[model samples]
Target: MTNQGTRQRFSPYITFSREEWRHLRDSTPLPLTEAELEQLRGINERVSMDEVADIYLPLSRLLNLYVAATQNLYQATNTFLGHLEAKVPYIIGIAGSVAVGKSTTARIIQALLARWPNHPKVDLVTTDGFLYPNRVLEERGLMKRKGFPESYDVRRLIQFVADVKSGKPEVLAPVYSHLTYDIVPGEFIRIRQPDIMILEGLNVLQTNPDGGRKRAPQVFVSDFFDFSIYVDAKEEHIKRWYVERFQTLRETAFRDEKSYFRRYADLTAEEAERTALSIWEEINAVNLRENIAPTRNRAHLILEKAEDHTVRQVLLRKL
Candidate 1:
């Protein structure tokens, strides 16, 4: 791995190599065990205890500090205004291309942050719930662009985040099933007032297309975030990971009778690889290039990963 100085300087972030970032973990003890990691890890993703100690521990510690600082600021503002204000949940947005391991990062951060003494009530919601139902997508001719921003009910998603940020006691969000690859009708996940909420998705950092130029309602999903992270990797590496995950799922989840991708389970290895590559090139790659990657610089932090699925560097946006 190259040192930070050797990397091209382009963004406003201060880059830290893996070793340099790992040193920031300090004395924070790992609260998670191997069994817990197995449960948190996504299919075809590798997350070891060492990786958590090196990468996520420092991240959780930094978030803890940020949460404390934000709370103090809120209290100070209330004091200056001479009025008591309700505490709102600290919202974090995690964005990345599919197979870049943002989901795993979100879950790990949720677990780690929850273990902290200051905030034990942490909730995670993926924007998958914000995706239009499969029938709706089909009706709108957006089935092929399922992960694109247009396939999501952006208004509803923004409303949910707004309500949460407004200190609502309880909020309901639609539930999505990976097995069915669609929203589950009549099902919703209820989140009560949590100390922290992690919203993870490919398009969480997306803004309005017009950039709020046309003075209509101009709320974006990212406006509610107190902090945001983008998990990043080279397109070629992410494409390989996507194909690998597809093959793994074909052998596992896709084999289920009720699985939406059951048809893929019976394909020969060569056919499966070809199909996965085609899907990557046609759908995932296009979305990453046109929609997802563009939001990487919008994140407060960027976790750049190596081909092995391990984060190799940390990029913290300069204050």
Candidate 2:
């Protein structure tokens, strides 16, 4: 815990309570209806309309201003260069532990930012697509370590982000499937030029990921980000949410024929719960403590969540 003492510094972050942060919304209207929000919520993640109006609306408004300012800086640089060039998209990176509702956060932020008139085309991309396929992981004996830093194709992920940030007219990213638990071969998500791009993943802020067969890349993913957010919650809260989600998936996705976890479909309530806890304790919790949680302060902003999954405090890095 001494490292945590070293890592947790008060000087960089200006902390705001939920009430104080929500007031910063400054009349920004809630963008999504109840149905849309419900659709966006992750398994076992409770996000209400009030969460949006209070937490996300203010966050979206801040992002809009940042994007506009970035766009202006781009124009100014172009003017100084004496030639007009295509402007690149503003990249926002979201990092968090598993079952902390990162995908929901990314989707909600994408929807809200796209609704802003200035930036109508906002794209959301996850680093899941950059993960190595099950075949490769099996070859490397990494099936149990899937979410760890070494399990990713870090070089390819870096190249993809570099291309996007460089304003490549069209870029392709590999597709990943949660149900099958593998990269979908020959399937890709094509990203056209967008006003903003949100990149969400567990380890986006990782500066140096080691212990793989391949050497670590020289570049960090956060280097290309205009701004970044880390979704923070207690480890116990995340583990509980993960187990609950696993149980929910046991009843739903696991029942599908194509699910990688189809064997779990017939598990009794006790068996399912026990299995979920074992996986979390053995795998996810280790990764969170060793790889993910340490990168929290690297974010431009940190959303500290309560046990109930509500934003209790917002920590914006001091400029």
Per-residue lDDT over 1-319 for candidate 2, one digit per residue giving the tens place of the 0 to 100 score: 5864555454588878999999999999887999998888888889999999999999999999999999889889998999978769999999999999888999999989999998999989999998889999999899999989999888899999999999999999999999999999999999898999999999999976664446667788899999999999999998889888989999999999999999999999899999999999999999999999999989999999999999999999988
Error of 1 at 109 (Å): 0.3
lDDT of 1 by residue, 1-319 (tens): 4554556465598989999999999899999999999999998898889999999999999999999899889889999999977769999999999999999999999999999988899999999999999999999898998988888888899999999999988899999999999999999989898999999999999885332344434788899999999999999999999889999998999999999999999998899999999999999999898889999999999999998988899999988
lDDT of each: 0.92, 0.92
Candidate 2, residue 120: the lDDT equals: 97
- Let me know the TM-score candidate 2 reaches against the reference structure: 0.95
TM-score of 1: 0.94
